[model samples]
Target: MRYFIIPALGLISLNTYANVIQYFTGISYANPAELFKIKQTELIIGGTGFHTVGKFEGSVLNFNTGQYGEGSAYTRTTSLLPYGRIAKRFNEKTVFAVDVTQPFHSNLNWDEQAFTRYAATQTYLTDIDISPRLSYSLSKQWYVGAGINLNFLQNNETNWALPINPTASANMVNRTTGFGTGYDLGIYHVFNQSNFLGLVYYSAIRQNTSGTSMLANRINPNLQFNFSLPATTVLSYVHLFNEKWLTNLQVFVSEWDVNQYVRFINTSAPPPLNPDFTFTMRFRKSAAFVAAIRHQYTQKTGLTLIGVIDHGPEKDEFRPLNFPSDTQYFLALAGDYRVNENTTIELLYGYGYEKTFMNNHVQVNGQNLPFTTGKVHLSANVVDLRLKIQA
Candidate 1:
């Protein structure tokens, strides 16, 4: 949340997830040894994604009755992110690859006239990373890999109801175009021909952003802030019953507790609006589980079913407006097609549902913002398609 006390007015709570709640979540994919089976070289292109549709509803309170009131509905829409990978097997025991992907991304908008406008209006954030990796097979059953990441992050947000004038709105913009560096390491092992295990770890990324808060009339410049992306670890298991039936289990963990508060620097505000202030971010260390089963119908085609259970990052009571649900469930169906000896394609479709967060509320500047506290409900549909070429 980006709420603040105005210079001449009362406390104003700004629900700005664009900057606070939208930090790096976790790794999009964790299979570094996925290309060990590629013959000599592989080129992947055209990342097709089915967008996520989020429906939001903010609950409001009636001060007169001292009770919570009804809420209004809003929706958030986003397109699929870009992803690509190119890998080359230099020898029987070594492989090299490069990947381009958007690991963290979000964009949302609210009705300007809605009761929840003061807490949040608009938010957009994106992070792009380019990775170069190398993998080696120490023996026939053991494999190891590592990668270097170059990251680029950007953010912008809008909030309404400035303390100076309740009807007024404010916008925030920042300059975060510098490249950051991080690394990833992975290990893979095969037991006999039926059991396999894999694990990957991604380091944290520190980003320093500087910018200002813009109002309808005045510009608040000379502001600076710093935040670090959380670290993540993933573990996976694969079981092959036969050539036609296989199963996979994966676990993903994110260490968001490492950095849960954001410190803001404003050199100009007086006393109460001192040079340094902090806000509790809406995130916590969490883990998710995925189960998948694949069936080989023929040599040229196959089908896979995947199910996911994600315990969201926010706790119920402390959850912010940005996190509408505490948990999410998803089921996906995927189809694989062997276009030819050199080309392969995969398409996946999924449906997800979020458990509603009810009676949600937050206090800013020690003031209970009933209007900003409300119930939230959301659900989504996702699609993904990718192509792989080998030679």
Candidate 2:
């Protein structure tokens, strides 16, 4: 059950608008090799809730003269994520598990009075993944697992854009829902009773989505697009120094660049209308590193501390008002306590701080706006609780 803390640490939130590593950073909820070794049926349930509050201050360039003036933005948001997993031991050499978790979720709401409102007043994206896996023990020290994932995605955006009429602006609303599939492969090795290593790879999934385009009524039937979810790879090493101390180190890479383009297709439009139109945001690949330490304080209680650093996605000169992300640092602490022979509980708290980023200019409705310089800073925290049942 101690391994549960590893993934919970990632529940911390910050400016991860592109591809939040926390969502896809963990191996299977319960390692197959570990489950085989324990030879017990286990069920796990947990949830994390994050409350984020921050300020964005920057300057917008005047359209006519390119002069810059300073302005500030503020936002407050809350995100709740819940997950469940069940691991079954078929026999000594075979183990199986199924997990349902939130892989991606983002919600941003900016002050309506800020200059950035024209680009994005509010935006939201949510995703869920269901994975079923089976593992086979190759030998006493080696085990391999494979699984398939079914993913569901949803996106919503609200902003003010240029209307056909030059005298007034129109409020725009867009919504989309999609489904995709992918696979997972993993290998686990036990060097000794106290040392272990694991590697896992998750494949990319393609989403072909169709949704209502209320603003594009002139374009005919509606809107459809292709969006690719990124692939991820994680390597975890666990070491037990003694009966009272343990440590884990994890490094992961996310190929967010696979999400190259989001081309919108309007099949009902005129002959001159092309099916492919590029969206505004461009995402880049990134990586994350985490180090965690656990200590047993008593017969039924333990404490763990974790530190994380994430390399954010590459930034573009044309910033998406709703998507402001950058490199970040996070710190977390967890407490695990055994309430009975069959039940255990864990509580976690985490904090995240992001480095400030700058943008020289912004584009809205095909019009260029210059800012002497604009910057964004973000910070967030999370609280999580988990329960484990073993038989």
Candidate 3:
């Protein structure tokens, strides 16, 4: 006979958690299912700091190796994003929760005199999500959950202000803001004492943005645009090998193809010259795989190791300077400590690596311009700290 003691909420899957700076897979927060799993009323606060550094080595106009100066080397930058969640159990079978998280964010800055200024100098994006969720214990072994999301988005970019002339290049800014809505559905099943499966789905949203565009400090009111955030689905499984050892498996699929193009409409008071601007962005469906292991070395301490690989979405078409993404891989180590009966602290360290394929072609005004380019190398480290208090 085999006997496995299952503690109150022992060996929960950790795959539901995501890397703080993952390649563009739309904006999604850590699965809320994990928050309600143990039926503990708790408040969790966490923050992630991602230190990213990269360089662009190739020529902007497909010329000689030294055609452009060393300005292509960018300076390192770090971004901090925070998240908070609170879950309360109204009854043994019902749970309510609220979450505030930064779903998607990025800031790419280049050297002030980078030759790529004509193409791109800087781009910043921010997305905030507010969610409310409800979970029901359908039965002893089954559970269901649902939630709604309100997302606010912002886009800001800076580049050479040249419209038709390349010699008269100046600094310019383009900015916009919008909002959207989405929903989430989740299911969890405990087949036996040692096995568990969880699934979640998040819907897509469309944002229509309008803002002013500045050229050398001059404002232009013809900077309205629109884009779509893709939907996502995740599946996770957990297996307990013994009372002290456990493993988790996770698979993610995101529909990122909807972000193919961004169309700018001129809404100026008086008709401006060429009030319509359209640009193409190459994006495709993507998937990722994750595996993790956890060991409860003692009653008060736990250690976890995680590895992830993402098959990023990209196309042969011209890649933009703002959003540079490719296949990504990561390794992470984490530790959890229980300070007391009502408090827990978790700390994580992760490293991410990516190499983007060279864009052998460029696009302008829906026209394809051929050029041989060099590869881009990107790397970042993410440090996360979280405090959870059970009330």
TM-score of each: 0.84, 0.84, 0.86
Per-model clash counts, in order, read: 3, 1, 0
- Report the backbone clash tally of model 2: 1
Ranking by lDDT: 3, 2, 1
Stronger candidate by TM-score (1 vs 3): 3
Each prediction's whole-model lDDT (CA):
0.62, 0.64, 0.66
Report RMSD (Å) for each prediction in the order shown: 5.0, 8.7, 12.0
Predicted candidate 1 versus true structure: per-residue lDDT over 1-391, tens digit per residue: 2335432211112221211111111225545765577689988774534344555565654322334435675756755566788889999988899988776655556655555544455545567888998888888898888888888865634243332332233333222333578898999998889999999988988766666655445556766656666677889999999999999998878776666666565623333444454556556776778888999989999999988877766665555454443666778888889999999888877776665554444444567554444456555566667888999
Per-residue alpha-carbon lDDT of model 3 for 346-369, expressed as tens digits? 988888877775564444334444
Q: Model 2 over residues 1-391: C-alpha lDDT tens digits? A: 0100000000011136323425322223334345555457878898877777667777643322234436787778998777878888888788888888777667777754456544455667777889888888999999988888898876633333323232332333445678999988888999999999988888888877777544434433466757676688888899999999999998878787775445655533222323334554456787888899999999999999988888776464634446566677778888999999988998888888775655634443344444324667677787778898888
Question: Which residue pairs clash in candidate 2?
Answer: 61-370
**In candidate 3, where is summed lDDT lowest over 10 consecutive residues?**
6-15
The better candidate by TM-score, 2 or 3, is 3
Best by lDDT: 3
